[model samples]
Target: MTKPISGFSKLTKEEKIDWVTANFTQNAAQSKKILQTYWNQNDSVQQLHDEFIENTITNLYVPQGIAPNFLINETLYAIPMAIEESSVIAAASKAAKFWLKRGGFKAKILGTEKVGQVHFIFKGDAKKLESFFTYLKPVLLAESASLTKSMEKRGGGITDIVLKNKTDELANYFQLHATFETKDAMGANFINSCLEQFATTLKKEATRYDAFSRQEKDVEIVMSILSNYVPNCTVRAEVSCPVEDLKLSAELTPQQTAEKIIQAIKIAQIEPYRAVTHNKGIMNGIDAVVLATGNDFRAVEAGVHAYACRNGRYSSLTHAQIENGIFKFWIELPLALGTVGGLTNLHPLVKLNLEMLQRPSAQELMQIVAVAGLAQNFAAVSSLVTTGIQKGHMKMHLLNILNQLGANENEKATLTEYFKTNPVTHHGVEIQLSSIRK
Candidate 1:
């Protein structure tokens, strides 16, 4: 059994790897070799990756792909996606191309307000706390002025600060709810710094307030942090065309396809079991772009899912309908993204991906990411309603299956052609490969 080791982080990279592999891995030599195999060749790059987190071992790489012909708001783009999934990029590309001639995607920023809070326990009269807050708000803002200076200069800063009395929910619980406009940066660090300052100011000012009693002056701060649930920081992306032009597959008529798509979304809206998987397909596109552009996909995931459940029930993020003679599909969801901070300036591929995206601002990135999600959802629903998702998905997955089976060049080429007409399945592919090998 492995024993806990203190000061493991203080060890050299090689020593750390040796210690972990020897204790934890059954084949330490093979494990060590596998870990070393992924290390960057350049010392400088390796050093940079090492400093990104504690106890770094080796880099886990995801494939970066491009989905071209994305026409958003009359502008053309080839969005970059970083993902390990098989058919995500292909599906996104297919959707983008399908919409390209039909007046591509149109996206607009709905809002850009981010939120943070300072939670605290105030055992005081409600009226007294309210009066004390009125006096303390300006001081909280003033003390955080230096921190907001640069952000303000960029046309972004603290928008508002309000005190909420939540004693009804939990005894003496209250929050200093604040909102901000962060411009081109994600502003996590900036928001956090200001929140921490507010907490300090609240504790100090309460003690000095003339309206506060001795017991009320002892405002116990629980925590100060930024929220990932940014409902107001949202964007909407959509594509519409005449219902007659909604030809997605040969088997279904344009009208049939459009109606089926609407029915599918309606099912997702009422059914949580389907809604979770439905929204996950949408995130497949959103997360890939967010990851490619060095934005926080995990944060985006949490916020989007929370927004899905905003109506007291989980529902689909994307919606579709047929109005008059037109077919329309769209998605509106919260996506807090930044193009100017965090790993954007650090990771080489992130920088390249941003440049490939024409260096979009935070709002622009939100619209782009939203469109990616809508496009992905459309592709998935279109597949589900027509030729079936497995047909195209499994076809795209053919190469991955073949590679995993260790099919060489000639074998891969032969099986690739064979599966073109036949269904692709793990067992089916294995049988075919074995038969060919014999």
Candidate 2:
């Protein structure tokens, strides 16, 4: 059994790895070798990566790839995606190419507003609290001037502040709801700074409010933070072409192909089981782009999943329809992205990605992200409706299995050509590998 040690973080990287492998791993030597192999050769670069987060041992790599030929609003772009999933980049690239032959994707910014809140408990009369808030609104805004001034000069700042009484849900619960326009940045820091100031101002002014008694004036601040559920910070991306343009088959006509695709989307909308996986496929694309751009994928995922269930049932994020001889597929969701802050300016690859994208503003990034998700869904569904999903997916996954079983380059090459016509399965590959060894 492994025993915990003190000052584990204080140990040097080699020492920590040595201790871990010795105590925990079955193949201690091999484990240490694998970990050390991934470390950056340059000491300076290795130190930079280690300092990115706490208790870093070595870098974990995900492949960075490009999906080209994405045309949104008459502007063409090649989207950068960072992901370990085998078929994701290929699927996105195929979808972009398919759409390019038809009229390309079109996207529009729906809104740019982000949200934050200050939660507090007020054990006071509701009417008294309301009266005090009226007096407190300007004080909250005025006190946040220093925090919001830089944001304001960039044409982005605090847009609105309102009081929300949630006493019925939980006793003495109240929130100061705030909204902001972050322009070219994700604005988590900006919104959080403003919220902290709101919390401080509310507490300071509550003591002097003429409307509150001593007990009422003592507002217990629970927390002040930015909300990831940015409903107003949204964009819509869609692709539309004549049904006749979807010539996907010789057996079934273009109209039939469109009908089948729409039916697949409809099932996802009404069925929760299918909807969950369906939405995940969409996020496979969204999250990849979000990571590549060095934005917060966790926040984006939380906000998006919340939005999915907003209609009471979690449904599909991408919608498809056949109308007036036209086939259209589209997606609309909130994405809090930044172009000039956070890892966007720090990570070298992120800066290169922004340059590759022509340095779009926040709104433009939203459109690009939404398009990636839509393209991903289109490719997935197109495969599901026609050739079935596993054909391409299993082929892509073959390389991973081969590497896992320790196939050399020559063996991998032979099997790659063999699997072109042969179906790939774990058991089947194992059998083939054994036969080759024999």
Candidate 3:
């Protein structure tokens, strides 16, 4: 049973914590201690973390790790990953190392165009609307010059604008579809600024258009924003080697292993349920790099998932094929990333992560992220075909179980060695932990 309190947001930080603990926590003092324990000791750094978002209590920490030996496009890299999931880093590293001797990964940028839209309703003649749009196009672009000037100077700016009539979808529904080339940056802010300006200009011009009646001229702007579904902002990463080159282990012959891997991927490609999880594995790699480099993982995830279902079926993002004694695995994803804006220059760890990768441009980062995803999928599917995904996943999950059961260092060491040969399960670990404590 909880009671509501007014002015919760306006309370002082200490007062807010007190109210939360008093109303919710069984042990208020311990709860307070736990929250404060995670705060940075450095005052300035703590302050910086607090301002990152609203209603900050304490920092929620995710392990920042590196998956080394990622050889992409004739260059070697150690990719930074920030995630809470067990086995993700280990799996990525294993995959990277496995491919290091097999010519590594090759990645290329397919496109860098981003999209934005200005939606409005025009209860007017279609012919008149078209005529008005023709005259308004250059004016809209010209009005946005101040906003796009800096981006244009950096070799990135608005690429094209087109008026789309969607009146059939909904009466008077229309959109000003715009495309952009945002080099070395995610360009959300730039695109959005330009779009708002377009919206304003459209409204102002419609008010003065000589050909429009009063009702027709009153164009109601629904919204102006950049779209996260950036199908045109895409990259591809692939790994190919001779069928005989996949000498991963002696348990399965290379040809058999290749067949199994391809079949596993094929099942995912045709099945929606499996494809969702399969694509999730790919995102585990992509998102880690995106977050480490101070880019928007949410935007990347949404766009990538949308792209996965672009063929009318939600299939696997990673594809596989075998032809002429050659085996190939690849993935193409729409990753809208940035290296010069947002958190790249703000957060300390983000700066370090970017510097560790030798300061890649947006395109370079895209290639790197795509390679990470491809490697991750290869490792996951390879394991699934051979030893089963759970074996390695459970092993990586052992530490988390141990921490949860409050195992001491000595107990953890013994259990760690024992589980190397035995399967790790929550119940099994708990029983062993209880026996050890007794």
Candidate 4:
């Protein structure tokens, strides 16, 4: 509501929560929980979290943190995120360091507006029913609050609406598409809230939307849910590394390192199965931020994967290339996403993250998120080009192996060296475990 906050700061925790709720559309249940979780200390058997996860989740607070030094479009901005992951901060920072000298990324948004689908099914002629929609269009346009004031103030809001009919292998269904622009808040809550009222007028126009039940066979409004396949908007970030900047090791040539990243991206583009993992790697940064902000990570993931197959071939959500000795990156996903309005306002950490980001508009949030995705992808590809994913992953995993036996730093290093030479297995670990014990 307040210019899609890039950060939430200077307010008491309660005020911060209030500010987020007033600005965005929060589920009623989530809002209540946010309030109760702050005051209530009941630690009964009713808690769903296991002891380990509970250590982080206690008090139902997931603080939001801002990622700094995001140089996008000549603007240095702070990004808000809700997540708990080791090395993400480190990775983003390292990635930013890699790009800083080469020239910061220039990122752009396709737009800020999103789409909502209100499905209505009834026994009527497709053409005549379509005409009925045409008749109702003017009426929908005439309504006030039809356009969000917050969006319209910033030059975005409901631009158009259409009704279309599509048939599946099962049957034909009617889908009413409400195309609206929400300025800073993710518009799902706004669109759904609007549709709740609009459905009233729609039911009056069509008999099918009016009735229900097994007692009679009639057209029904089965489920009215917001679609995350936001085609109207896309965010892109591009950074060029001079061929010289790619050097991380003496053995690898800058061009070869860039080439390896390009080759990996090419594989992701061509292979659907690999693309899934490829995108998942990118989402490691994305979902962590989403969870940190109280936004729906699952919905964002679903829509991104669904959008990946827009051309009917499963492919990577991101595209990377090496041109003129510089590595370029771009990602196009239906970032129909938000920072406030749901659990973002409920959870503690998420609140902290938004406070740090201070983003007021959804478009700004998307820009930061898109940049993070690009940065994360770059880190992933860079890591792959140098040492490979397994080695880096195993490096972190080895710490756990060392800790289980209380090995000191030097001992842990020695154990890692042992694993590098030996066949890694539980049985092998046990054998080494004995040797280390002695």
Candidate 5:
């Protein structure tokens, strides 16, 4: 059994790695060597990575790929994606190319409201609490002025604060629900700072209110935090063309292809099991761009799923239809993205990716991200209704399978070309490689 070590964080990086490998790993020397091998060659870059987190081990690298020919809002862009999954970039690029000749994608921001909350417990009269909140609302905003000043100067700040009563759900539960306009930054830190101040102010002012009894005055603050469920911070991306021009494959007529795509989306809409995987396919494109741009993909994921289930049933994020003679497909996503803060300013690759995007504003980035998702869904559903998803996915996964079997470069090249015509499967690839070697 391994014993817990004291002051682990205080140890030097080498000492930490040494202790970790010696205690936990079967082959400490090999583990240490592998860890060191992944470290950046440039001292400065390696040091920067080390400081990104505590008890630093080694950087875990994900491949950064570019999905080109994404035409959003009449502007062509090569969107950068950082993900480990195979076929995501390929699927997104294929979708983008398919839409390029059909006049590209149209995107626009629907809203940009983010939310924060200060939850508290108040064991007092409901009427008195409401009266006190009416008076305390201005104080909450006033006390957080210094924190919001800079954001306000940038034309982004606290929009409104409302008092919500939740006693029916949980005893003595109330919240100060505040909304904000964060402009080009995600503004999580800013919103959280202001919320903390509001919590402080609420507690302080409650003690002085003449209408409140002693028990009411003793308001207990639970927590103050920014919400990741930003339904209002939304963007819409869409592509449409005449039904006759919707020739996705030579196997199906334009009308049949359009109907199949719509039917696939409809299935996702009603079926939760299908919707989860369907949305995941869309997120493959969305998260790749979100990670490459240095935003919080986890937060985006949470908010988007919450939005999907907002109507009480989880459903598809992408919708398709044939309106008259036109075939239309689109997605509206809740994306709270930033172009100016967090990793956007710190990570070298993030900065480069933003520049490659022509330095899009938060709204523009939202539109771009939404388009990526819509494109991905279109590609996935189109493939599903025609050639089947595995046909293309397995083909893209063939290289990983080959490399895993330790095939040489020439073998890999030949096998890749062979799989272009032949079906790609692990067992088949192994047999083919073995025959070639023989």
Candidate 6:
């Protein structure tokens, strides 16, 4: 049995699956959906069409397991995530269990506002394009000033909007940076709505032009896309653990473990090339939750990479430190995520996760996400510093094999002994299982 810690409940291996199956709510709700909007069986756009001859996308219903032991922003939260990776759920829960000996994760956010961009493409003529935007900017702003949604009225709206010119190999293009204020939403749908409205107005004004009449003078829209350069909202989480508790399972001095883990992370952060894989490990935790909740995982993925290289120095999404024998950690990913929009509220698994977390506010969910990231990092680092990651994970792999082989209790014991003694082989397992059945 695992040692007990405050604000956390320890589960045996069996209970973990039960918990996931419960809160992920596989039994209570219908998970499978053949919809045009979301596709999981078919992972991406190219794969869906060329490979699979299916028009409808498959909405995946992966398990949303709660990572126990987190207290962020004065609220205790059991983070619920959906991911299929072997170690992520286990590693995060292990770290949370250890951290429970302390006060758990404390976190804060800068604000809940987000920013989006809309690109406007013009013709190849440089001087002609310049003259068009010069006239269009005033028309674009003045005509759409009152068009500001509830966001602008409620102390936050399109505070800053600007246009930029680009000369790429394809053609000359202009982009409208619509820096809008999204109070709590990640603002993808809302911003896109505003962009559609603004774009329609701009195109309408262009039709009545008494200006440049050449065929190339028209605002040829290459792509009026929404930009992922998020607003100034930053999320931070801090978790501390008792040294005495960590010393039990890990067998290393708490300070030594912390130092070793932090050093490995520093290496991952310092190098740009290594930082790619490093941040991937972080996203192993983030993407799971985002996917589970039916939020835009792609946007979160974009924001993370964008945030990593923001300062020209490539760094890990999370930072860890040992201060006064306390393991302090913080992650500042651009969690430009929304709770109210997209499939977040539609999917059953996501709804269950949200309910299990006690239905936190938008900002609170971001903090919880950061906490999961912190726990996941700590989990991975602790194992790497002490016993190496494969030690626990490999055992789980063996158990999975056993389940796949359909070994009964007595046969499982016999197979375990055989596995421990003999060289491993998939063919051998099939033959042996066949013989046992016969």
The lDDT for every candidate, in the order shown, is 0.94, 0.92, 0.92, 0.68, 0.94, 0.67
Model 6: residue 137 alpha-carbon error in angstroms: 4.5
Q: Please tell me which predicted candidate would have the highest lDDT against the true structure.
A: 1
Model 4, which residues run further than 4 Å from truth? Answer: 1-69, 77-87, 143-156, 168-172, 207-219, 343-348, 358-360, 404-433
Worst 10 residues of 4 by lDDT: 49-58
Report the Cα RMSD per candidate.
Answer: 0.8, 1.5, 1.4, 10.9, 0.9, 12.6
lDDT of 4 by residue, 1-438 (tens): 258654455454455566655666457457746665654354542142322232222244444455677777776766665455545665776677777667787777886667776676655566666666777776665563654666578666678878877765336577778777766567777787666555656665554422332222244666666678776677777787667677875779988887777788999999988888888878877887676666777888887888888888889877767677566777876677665566555555556666766653566667777778778888877887786665555544565656776777877777788777555554556577678779
Writing each residue's lDDT as its tens digit, candidate 5 over 173-212 gives 9999999999999999999999999999999999999988
Candidate 2 has its poorest 10 consecutive residues by lDDT at 245-254
Minimal lDDT window, size 10, model 3: 7-16
Model 2 per-residue lDDT tens digits across residues 221-259: 999999999988899999999999887657778888899
Ranking by lDDT: 1, 5, 3, 2, 4, 6
Is 4 or 5 the stronger prediction by lDDT? 5
> Candidate 3 vs candidate 5: which has greater lDDT?
5
User: In model 1, what are the clashing residue pairs, if there are any?
Assistant: none
List candidate 1 segments past 4 Å from native: none
Instruction: Report model 4's TM-score to 2 decimal places.
Output: 0.75
RMSD of 3: 1.4
What TM-score does structure 6 among the candidates reach? 0.73
What global local distance difference test value does model 5 have? 0.94
Q: How well is each residue in 304-325 modelled by candidate 6, as lDDT tens digits?
A: 7888888888778777777676
Q: Which of the two candidates, 2 or 5, achieves a greater lDDT against the reference?
A: 5
Candidate 2, clashing residue pairs? none
Ten-residue region with minimum lDDT total, candidate 6: 28-37
User: Candidate 6: misplaced stretches above 4 Å?
Assistant: 1-61, 111-113, 123-138, 141-156, 167-171, 206-217, 229-231, 241-251, 312-314, 323-326, 413-438
